[model samples]
Target: MASMELTDGYDEECFRTIVLAGSPQELRERRIACQSILLEQLNVIPIEEWMFRVNTMHDLIAETAVLICEAQMKEAGYGPPPCTYSFIVFGSSGRQEATLWSDQDNGLIVEGEPDGEKNRYFEFFGIMLSDLLEEVGYEKCAGKVMCSQGMWRKTLSEWKEQLKEWRTQLEWEPIRYLIISSDMRHVAGSTELSALWQKAFYEGFIDNEELSVAVLRNTVRHKATLNLLGQVLTERFGDYAGGFDIKYGVYIPLVNIVRRLSLLHRIRASSTLERIEELERLHKYQHLDDIQRAFLLAMRMRVNTPFSVQNGLLISSDYIAESELKNKQLLSELRESLLLVRRLHRALQRQLRSAERWRT
Candidate 1:
């Protein structure tokens, strides 16, 4: 398909005109049309610019979903949300790094107590919003992280208490939740609620050594994709045999390391690139330019392919057919990127260890 011409630039007005121009059903259809334009334009735009475009498209979809939920609530006589709430997205969407077929990972933070009536109201709207999002193309999160889930949709005090529990427990599951919650960004509704949630989360890590160690442990849990022989590892078995798990094997480790360091540095930026830039500005890390370039290259590769959900997890293939892998130049670039990931991982580990020593 020929790429869409970008004459007027990507703005909210253009987004509304294209994706929100018609009836509810028609709006859902138009949202997919907008995605098609974005996918096509992905081929021509710079990787960074393309990522921004994708995020904007996601924001538009979420806003439209919120509108749908509002309409539904009005029809049911709920009369909009009872209390101020922030629709917060986590994972890639939260970091403004969504790929072409990203699934939803979001939740809600409402002001005041989670009374029975108010809880029911938000719960109904949450399910409505998730359903609308799925209809428009974004898949529901497999982890049940969406606002439709009771565990995710909570009052501000409830969320603060939850964070405290996670910090106190410091178990594997709780630590995992803490890390995931770290990436949340406010998509709609009250920004104050979102800020309060963030404050609670960041404060949990302040001068907390045990929490820092838990984060470090989780951050290094995954092994790099490159083996000791420096060969890129492919899936040994499965439908994706001979294909690389780029999402987990490369992108995730980089994200984890950057996120951990960002938290340690008290930088609140969620995007991996943004965290790296902040670390560089703080003179905290060395050779950030190369690391950023490699990270961007990996992102470009992942976004170039269509994403799929398998076993309820979002997966993308990095499979270069053996025939294609025989192309010396292409092979070299792929190997170089994988090696850079390994190098960056090692560098991050060293920095963390050094920080631990300094802390003592």
Candidate 2:
């Protein structure tokens, strides 16, 4: 395997050399090689360090891919982009919490009028960028959240309008999209665009009682993976039978709680740990340090385990083998983590109820 040691600072040229050296046919293989090298080092690093490094690496890959796509478009006789644009990533990548395997959950925020010509320019740009990312091993999001989709590729004004609709309507799907968009972080292009959108988003939900309740209701829908018997809840059927889904069961509830708290507090930090720290700094919640510790433990378990993936998307199995569960220490840690999640969920529910009562 090639040396996986990252250079001391951002090395744009080095990334370009690696990415641009390969032909389209070989791009996927090269990307996998780079990812494998990076993955090899993740096991030994602290979870926080691993997240930061991997996020930085992925950012480099995105920048390089955009540059390559620009060249490809120019060669294909397309003119330069009509206006400034920002590429925003959401979900785990946006939160800087991506595991070794991830799919693209991204969108485009173009600064231009809502005109057909401008829309077409961005449309083409989104497609090229999405294609380049796929060639480099980032699978298209199953949710169709990629910028290549019309709904996700939009002008700044369009995004604002969409946010308005999402906030005002309070429908399930729109609210869900709004929650996901809350994680948006600009990875490339005009950095200010995402900030503007986020400002609008925060302002939209800050004093909206209805929206807050709806968000809380949606967030608490995912039950903790631990059953009443204090045993890890394993899948009863499917290919992953006997394996628990750590992603949805443990990681996502924590994420949802952190996200809702950040919204409630009007905190802008995107990562779960950062949000927790910010909440702590404000003395907003009790046992935050313990919560943070539990979250990191969960993250470590996530990175250390080999997950099953299908079509390049992680299959949600933070699967602990039955044998590993039989080990007292391992089982104890797992139960403790799940218990923490349950406690946190209840605390959040109490907070929500308090806020709702105050509103009433």
Q: Estimate each model's TM-score.
A: 0.89, 0.89
Q: Residue 240 in candidate 2 has what lDDT?
A: 67
Candidate 1, residue 264: how far the Cα is off, in Å = 0.5
Misplaced by over 4 Å in model 2 are 1-30, 307-318, 350-360
**Segments in model 1 whose C-alpha atoms lie over 4 Å from true places:** 1-7, 10-14, 18-24, 306-324, 347-360
Model 2: lDDT equals 0.77
Return the number of clashes found in candidate 1: 0
lDDT (tens digit, per residue) of candidate 2 on 1-360: 011355534333334545564344455554555555556766676678767766766776776677677778778778787778898999999898876677899999989668877877778889988988877667789999999998898888989999999988877888999999999888888888888888888889767889988788678776658778877887788866776666777888888888988898888888898899789988857877877887887787777665565543334445655555677886687788888888878776787788678778
> What TM-score does prediction 2 earn?
0.89
In terms of TM-score, how similar is model 1 to the real structure?
0.89
Question: Which clashing pairs does model 1 show?
Answer: none
